[model samples]
Target: MSDMPPSQARSRTKVKPMTSKGTGESDTGGVRADVWVWSVRLAKTRSAAATACRAGQVRVNGQRVKPAHTVRAGDEVRLRQGDRERIVVVRHVLRKRVGAPVAVEAYVDNSPPPPPREAVAPAGIRDRGTGRPTKRDRRDMERLRGLAPKPHE
Candidate 1:
């Protein structure tokens, strides 16, 4: 019951192959910076990657770039998240998100090792049936954690 010709319908259904800019390569196409980050599991989500790019927390080859910036193999990307910074060198350009193991192969992490965890002193714990802590108990707990001065008397 369709009026359109078969040729017209076929043309409309054609899918374009992904390609990289300035290169005729279809298998290794350049992807957006944010997409690359998210695809490789660097960021939890694509929106997070784009947000990081917008906040100037992402850099490529030492130059700040936008979310739409093109990323190719061999590009060095640096991302800052909270107190830690991650540096990774692109080994492969991936367009779609992949599994953790597969994603690891797409980049070479060049970030410094994380800081060692400090040994924390044991904190005072009240009994399960105990009610709200008294002001004096709170102050004692704070002092134990070096948060407040010890009582004079």
Candidate 2:
């Protein structure tokens, strides 16, 4: 009979190691697509990554993949969240979440830079408690928004 504690015995049990695809060398195997994304800080949560995968918001190597799909190093991953898209080349495969600095090292960002904030026109905002705008006020707001031409005085 073993003298080891039950917890220790369980911990010592051998688990099957996953093999890397293509390469014959045995190392850490491919990580699940959703898990990899979440671990690398691409998504806020593991469930969020899975949700993105299920919603077809995530693509691996240019092909939409399921949450359980495997992802390896050097693969290109594209994630579309709202109006912005993130494109990254997988530099390493990780199954556990890591620090922000370490997470950044896991992927090579290839996404285009976001447009400058100055390029966006500010929305017209009326003062609080102003109630409804008068016809003149409305025309002025429209003109400010470039939706209507200025009226001749």
- Candidate number with greatest TM-score: 2
In terms of lDDT, the best-performing candidate is 1
Clashing pairs in 1: none
lDDT of 2 at 48: 100
User: Once model 1 is optimally superposed onto the true structure by TM-score, how far is the C-alpha of residue 10 displaced, in angstroms?
Assistant: 2.3
Error of 1 at 137 (Å): 6.6
Clashing pairs in model 2? none
**CA lDDT scores, all candidates in order:** 0.86, 0.86
- For residues 82-114, write the lDDT of model 2, one tens digit per residue: 878999998878877778887888889999887
**4: Cα error in model 1, Å:** 11
Q: Backbone clashes per model, in order?
A: 0, 0
